[model samples]
Target: MDFVLVHGTTQSPAGWDRVAKLLRAAGHRAIAVDLLTPADLPVEGYAQHARDQYDGERPVVVAHSGTGVLLPAIAEALDARAMTWVAAYIPDFSGGRSLRDEVVELFAPEWIGVDPTADPAKASEFLFHDCDPETEHLALDSLRLFSPAVLAAHRAGPAPEIPSTVIVPTRDRTLKPEWMRQAARDRLGVTALEIDAGHCPHMSRPAEIAGILTGHA
Candidate 1:
């Protein structure tokens, strides 16, 4: 099956490199998308950019972190086959809250703002505690700043009606695993699949992440 990987905000498609490599090695096609900044456009535009990258194949869309908010629109656009969330922020549209509001309420105040990438040490500690030093360094160096507008954006419509799975990293320091479980159940109506890794599982545990994507786990 074709898999389109959508990364979280402030992240480049390179974040999915290891997972994509593993998927390709397993004979599955993978497309890691570099999401466009919503900027002045409606937040749905981000989903449109993701859909535009598709070549008409009904793909299993795997979204990581903040990009999970775009799944409903992307799935609506492509009639996606399925979706998987990796340590992602599942939007609660019912609460009438914007993504930025949800994030601010969820994380510590110090973690919010223009860019956490500016502090490589803190970023690495929070995002890559389970990863090796080399991998952590690479991730920190490649980090980018997301536009504030992206955070302020709200979902344009209801959640997509489709088969979905949530992959929760039990060791994630950034997003608590229990919180992910509750959010998945409350918002997405699905029980999360737990992994023994941190927030960036594709970087720390690519083979296992691929296994889940391929339905082998």
Candidate 2:
């Protein structure tokens, strides 16, 4: 099966290198997308970009972190066989507030000017704590800044009708595992598969993550 991996806002396609390698070694196709910037596009536009990049038949769409909000749209556009959320945000629009508002409310003053690309050390501490030295350095060096507008956009649509699974990082320091479990159940209506790693398990535990994706876990 083909797997289309969509990275998070602060990340590039490079982040999926390890996992993609493992997937291919296991005899499956893995395509990682470097999402277009300014990332100001609506969910539909993002989905179109994903569809344009993938030219395979019924690939499974996987999203990580903030990009999870675009999974439903991307899956629908590509006619994906399944969807996977890897330490990703499961959108809930019941609060009648945009994602940006929730982010501002959650992080307050610090979220405004915080740039992961500009501060590799801070990014390492938060996002790549469990990764090896080389992987962590690569992540820091390849970090990219996402448009603030992307955070504010609301996921305004019904959930896609596809088989979905949520992979939760039990050791994640960025997004708590408990929160992810609740979000997976409440929003995605699926029980999460807990893994022993940080936020970026694709980098930290590539073999294990690959196993999960390939139905070995």
Candidate 3:
């Protein structure tokens, strides 16, 4: 099966390196997209840019963190067979709220204005605490800074009708575990799959993540 790994904010394609490698070793194609959109671009532009990365494989699209807001559109465009959201934001398609609104309401005060790319120390402690030194270093080094303006610019559309699963990182320090569980149940109407890791599970627990992906389908 083909898998498209969509990264979150302040992240590069390298963030999915470990998981992608594991998938490939198991004879599956994995494309880790680099969706570092420019600050001037809106969420629509970000969606289009991400769509253009693949050739309509209808793969199982996996979204991480901030990329959740872009998932519905990207999934519809790709005609995805299945979707997996990893400690991600679930957009409100009712035209009720924006990504910024969700962040302000759901995120912890300390995580509000924090940029992982700008502060590697903070990122290491919060986002990659479970990772080894080398993995953490690689993640920190590959961070890409971008404006949060795009979050406010996002206008979510109806989510596609497909098989979707939400994976919550039980030990995550950045995004609250309670919110992850609540959002998964209330927004997606499904029980989340829990994993023992920090924010970047693909980096810290690649084998476990890969096992879930393969077994899920």
Candidate 4:
């Protein structure tokens, strides 16, 4: 199976390195799309960019953090076999609401309207508290800044119902875990798989993530 991993807004594709390596070791093709470059694109444009990055057969598209806004469109464009959201936003864009609007209230007070990429310490504290020193350092150093335009992007139409799973990070310091569960149930209409980790679980718990991916596939 092919897995296309999309990183969060403040992250680089390298964030998916550990997970990708494990996926490959398990005989699966895993590709992490670079959604940061040309960061001015809208939600739909980012979906197109994600599609162009991988040419594999119908893939299992995975979204991490803010990148979940791109999942539905990317899934449609790529004819994805399944979708996975990792402590990620699940934008409904219903009533023409922007991704930020849908998820803003769920963010921690310190995280709202602040650029996580600007402060490595805060990024590590909020997103990588569960990570080892090596992985935490890599994630902090590779943090990327995104334009406000992308945060304001919204879908114009409803998305098709696809097989999907949400992994909620119970110890996440940025987005509230309680809301994550509620959102998954209310918006995605599914119960989330709770994992004991911070926001960036791929870096902190790659083995477990890889197991879930392979097991579900």
* TM-scores of all predicted structures: 0.90, 0.90, 0.92, 0.93
Model 3 agreement with the true structure over 1-217: per-residue lDDT tens digits: 9999998876778888989999999999999877774456666676677788987577999988887887877777777899999888888766557877777666766877787777888888779999988888888876876445766557676656878888889988878889889877777778999999988898889899999999896
Give the number of the best model, judged by TM-score. 4
lDDT of each: 0.77, 0.79, 0.81, 0.83
Q: Give the Å error, residue 203, model 4.
A: 0.6
Clashing pairs in 3: none
User: Would you give me the overall lDDT of model 1?
Assistant: 0.77
Model 2 pairs whose backbones collide: none
Model 2's TM-score against the true structure: 0.90
Superposing every Cα of model 3 onto the true structure, what RMSD results?
Answer: 1.7
91-131 in candidate 2: lDDT tens per residue? Answer: 77454455665564333243345677888877787778898
Position 20, candidate 1: lDDT: 91
* CA displacement after TM-score superposition, residue 94 of candidate 1 (Å): 2.6
Per-residue lDDT over 1-217 for candidate 4, one digit per residue giving the tens place of the 0 to 100 score: 9999988878888889999999999899999998766347767787888888999888999998877777888888889999999998777645566665655577887777677788777887788889888888887876887554665566546656788889998999988888889878877788999888999899899999999888876
For model 1, where is the 10-residue window of minimal lDDT? Answer: 105-114
Q: Rank the candidates by lDDT, best first.
A: 4, 3, 2, 1
lDDT for residue 205 in candidate 2, whole number 0-100: 92
lDDT-wise, the better of 1 and 2 is 2
TM accuracy, model 1: 0.90
